[model samples]
Target: MTTATTDLAASRFALARQVADAVLFEGYVLYPYRASAAKNRMRWQFGVLVPPAWGPDHGEPSCQRTELVMEPRGGAEVAVELRFLHACRRTVEEARADGTFADVAALHLPDRVLVPWDEGTEERVEMSIPVAELEAGEVCLPFTRPAREETEPVPGTDGRTVGRLVRRTERVDGVVRLRADPLDLPYRALKLTAVVENTGDWTPPPEGAGREAALARSLVAAHLLLGLSAGSFLSMTDPPEWARAVVGSCTNRHTWPVLAGEDGRADVVLSSPIILEDHPRIAPESAGAMYDATEIDEILALRTAALTEEEKREARGTDARAAAVVDLADTMPPEIMERLHGAVRALREITEPGAQPVQGRDGPGLPGEEALFRPDTPWWDPEHTDPAAPHGDRVLVGGTPVGPGSRVVLRPGLRRTDAQDLFLQGRTALVEAVLRDVDGGVHLAVTVDGDPGADIRRAQGRFLYFQPDELAPLEEA
Candidate 1:
């Protein structure tokens, strides 16, 4: 390849790694960052592949599979990388006068605090194969991580070993299998399947085992980063009309495949355990990783900064990554901190006075310009003109027009991820307004009827939001 082509590929690979790194450590550590935190104890909940013996009995998966549509050029090949964390148990011990050492959860040295914790060692298995090879037959690549243990001695003021830190890792083995099938669609394309299984030999944890036991013999944060040496891969989430049916036919087990790297480029796909939009990018303003991807960076930064000196010391002793997060929070510059508070991606100035009003999804919006967006009012203003006028909008629920003040029965759908939504089922609610997300999806803001606290909730302009389809219109109300 030419130098420019190689440089572009290198750049794209780096970009893909940026997003994949976020997924890799999404829940690696929580806000407090201290090992003593309760939430920190129940960790490794995402993208975990346990031993086959420890199946869904404990709600853990033993395999991850991703299927994608690839318009392969003749003789095109693909490179696959399975990235995950290898959990290593670290134990802190203190030496006694009798030459015996006892395990201590925390041991304080003169310069730093030391804590025993399960630290993750980043592990990856990568392989490349020709399209002909995968099309002809399944190609299996088996990998293994051997068991090992290491010790680091802590010196006392007199330079003698006062304590020791022991790290132990178990043997981990897995396999990645790849296969391709040619499609007979209008265009030349091939369906590719990649499967990752924890083939490690191990006895399953007893029934009702906590996540920690199974995680010891599992592949934590297991995800695949796929690259096409030639040809583009079709997005599983948003495919063209012609490939919609094909995309639907593709099956993904315990993984969500989305285009990665450069925007609108399909050369790389990140098959993440957590669902992600295509071309996911880390915020340029992000100072460092806190591991809780759902929370805003500014909030996390503030919370980290609020940690007491002792708490921060414990967090620093928890893991190397946690130390980095604590350091970043304590020293973040004011300018960078402000940038994390808010970011504007787009701005439009009203240039014409005679422009028509913006047309909303439900009906016409307040008119003053060609676009409904007003320069004077914030985009979220309830009384202002906007593309999606929530208060003025009505959604059809079971052929019944439901809008503000309309009564409906809540029936939370599969789209609701929270378990609390179960209580909302069959509950009658008054639709406060119709809210639209940036993706153009409509949501119904509602207040539960007959609830004593609902009135106060309404007064505060706070209402529970649900998808329009998760509601049923009441006939009489």
Candidate 2:
């Protein structure tokens, strides 16, 4: 590739890396960010490619498959970059009187406390092939990280070695097999499949070897960054009608591929272990990586800052990245912190046909701007009609004023908003917010009480909406 062309590709990958990095460290550490925290005990949870033997028995997978469709022009080339984390075991040892070091769970120094932890090192495998070559023959990228150990001395105030940190990484072996075949379509589209398998020879110690034992042999946060040197990739999540069936024909196992990089340009695809929409980008409000995708940045930052000083210190000693997250949260600029609080991206117009108008101080919105409220809210009130100012709105549910925080049993009307509402038939939920529709309809945004994922749903702002009339309030105990 020419230098300029190579530079352009490098720039594209750089933009793509921001998102992939987020995925890489997700769940690497959780809230509180302390080693002693229960949540941090079980690590390497995301996209873990374990030994094939331990996978079936332990409910983990040994491989992740990513399949995507692309339109390749003549002489178009595709380059695949496999990125993942190789688990490393870090042990904190204290210096003995006789010049030797002994492994200790925690080495307490004047400033910080060091603890034993398993960390991940970034690894990648890259290869490129012409689309024709990929279609004709399969390509393999066999990757290996050799076992190695390193030690860094932790010096005291006087510069003497009070303790040392020893990090050992096991030999991790994996392979990525790439192949492509033409889809029988009117257009020139190719279906590409990339399978990543853990070919590590490490044997499972025993049935009770625990997850860590297998994690050492696994590929953590394994994902792919696929680039089309020429043509563009199609969106599997929202494909055009012509290629809808073709997307269905593409089989993806334990992986979700979505168009990435610049918006509207499908030259890059991020094959993630978790679900994501097309052209997904990081929220601009995020201050930094908190290593938890399910929770809001503001909440995590606030929670991290709220950690006790002792707790924070312990968290800082867990990993350098974890320490940075804590420090960012603790010392984040006021403006940045405020931005994380929230923002209204855009208003969807609920002023469609049969929709009602919402009153505003300036006598309802302009006909020009009124059409922006239809997508999300059934009612169009950006602070006037629907959600903007409905939080305080109360409706009588079983003769009780039901507003935010009111408990109610859902009785979704026969005209169901969603088929899944059937499962929530009589479940009790807490009203999170009250919203009004342009049609004068009221929606009670609620979360099911006792639901295992209730907190996560709340954190994700994913609550089920129901009309107030469909709810029967329960008195607070």
Q: What TM-score would you give candidate 2 relative to the actual structure?
A: 0.76
Expressed as tens digits, the lDDT of each residue in 144-250 for candidate 1 is 99989999988988999989999999888899889999887999999999999999878754545656666877899999888888899998866888998988999
For 231-305, candidate 2 gives per-residue lDDT tens digits of 889988668889989898888998899888986688999999977877777898898888898999999998898
Residue 406 alpha-carbon offset, candidate 2, angstroms: 34
Candidate with best lDDT = 1
For all candidates in order, the CA lDDT equals 0.81, 0.80
The most accurate candidate by TM-score is: 2
Regions of model 1 farther than 4 Å from truth:
1-11, 98-100, 156-159, 205-210, 346-477
Error of 2 at 142 (Å): 0.9
Global Cα lDDT for candidate 1 = 0.81
Off by over 4 Å in 2: 1-6, 206-208, 348-370, 373-477
